[model samples]
Target: MQIIVVGIGGVGGYFGGRLALTDHRVEFVARGTHGKAIRENGLEVKSIDGDFRAFPYKVHETLDTIDAPDLVLVCTKSWQLEEVAQQLAGRIKSNTLVLPLQNGVESVEKLTGHLDPGQVLGGLCKVISKIDGPGIIDHFAFHPQVIFGEVNGERTERAIALEGVFRSAGIDVILSDDIQLAVWRKFLFICMISGMGAITRQEIGVMRADEHIRALMETSGKEILELAKHKGVGLTEKDLENAFRAIDAQKYHSTASVQRDLMAGRPSELHDFNGYVVREAEKYGVEVPVNAFIYYCLRPMEAKSRAHE
Candidate 1:
């Protein structure tokens, strides 16, 4: 398969690095020092799965100068999704598939706004990773996996073929029957935890262990659930419990990249996660005290961080 990985951050770097290990044509789109490092020394991955180097890999600074690819992995942060999708609009073959592995529920909705709806897949990835240095990726925790499917729940040939491609790289993958629901499930978990992490400025274990902090997380999660309900997304009590289960299973020091970015005075997916709920809640006439508080509290930091960029 001719694959184009648009971002070489933790999510893309690990998955794209794995694909690079295959016979498949895996090209990368990276920038600045990181792009130069990969171009000069190849991409290095330090993983619990075992360290490996994928050299002789193609790295592009932009999507220009490339022919149509079989698949385009939209690996940019949630806040960059729209701009990336716009760049991809009408640039790929009609049959090409675009999958978003970001931690959000509106990936497909956002992508379809710019590209052919049929060409976009509802997707999400489960992995704990980050860039350790220029041209280097660190897979620190979690058994990585990609789950995706047609937005309408069909077992399409393309979705199956993509799963096979991931498996060929020894990457765990799933083809969901209801991908929209799957994305919402993941969002439900990510937004709650990430919001709490930012609000408390604490790690997962610390927040989970503190009674008041844990309750705050639950309250914020319920707000998200209410907003999802109004948006026609089915989120049940069982799903909330399942989200907490995953949170509990995390290593104590765990923190989402969004939190890490904010802590380091870098721009993050603040609007895409908690702020998204606040806006939608107003649209749906639902109250979201917890999520609103989190979003407003972090807005100044997020703005100041972006100003530096």
Candidate 2:
């Protein structure tokens, strides 16, 4: 399969580099120093599993050099969706399948505005990773899973074909039947962990260890579940329990990526995570105090980020 990874950052870089190293025809789309490094020195991934470098692959800043790929992985940050849509509008063929490995629900719709709905798929990537430097992806986790499904919720040939490609490349892929619910449940988990961790500047281990923070996490999760119910997303009691159970099982060692980004003074998915909950809460006439508080508190940090810039 000819794959084009549209963002060579943490999630994209690590997965794309791994596929390329496995001798798949992977093209990485990057920019600035990272793009230059991949073009010159190759793409490198440093992970707990081990480290590997892939030098025999293509890297470019744009799609101008490549033809329409069979599959396009939209791995860019949620904020970059608009520009990515515009770029992909001309690059992707009608048959091209675009899988958005973005955080929020809005990405699929946003990209659908630019492409056919049949061509866009929902994808969620579970990994603790980030870019350490140019051409280098720093991953801290061993278990990396990519969950995805067709938008229409059927077992389509495109979905299966893509799954086959990913599986051949040695990836843990789950073809979900209820991807929307899966997305929301994942969002609930992220909102709880990211909001609390960003607000308190604490890791999951620290947060769970503290009784106060643990309660906050649980409350924030409940708020999300409530909001999901209000929105008629069809979330189940099992969904709520399963999410909490996963958190409990993790022993709180699993931290939010947003928390790590905020601590490092990097850009976070704050708006998409906590801010999304607050916005949706207002729409449903639901009060999400914990999420609202986290949104307001970390908002000022955006200014801090600008000042540094």
Q: For this target, which candidate reaches the highest TM-score against the unseen true structure?
A: 1
Best model number under lDDT: 1
What is the overall TM-score of model 1 with all chains considered together?
Answer: 0.98
Give per-model TM-scores.
0.98, 0.92
lDDT string, candidate 2, 147-260, tens digits: 999877999888988898888767789998878887887787677778688888866778777898888888888888888888778777677677777666564566677887
Please, what are the lDDT tens digits per residue for candidate 1 over residues 181-254? 88899989999888679878899999999999999889988888888898888898899999999999999999
- lDDT for model 1, please: 0.90
Model 2 poorest 10 in a row by lDDT? 246-255
Q: How many backbone clashes does candidate 1 have?
A: 0
- Candidate 1: C-alpha RMSD to true structure equals 1.0
Give stretches of model 1 more than 4 Å off: none
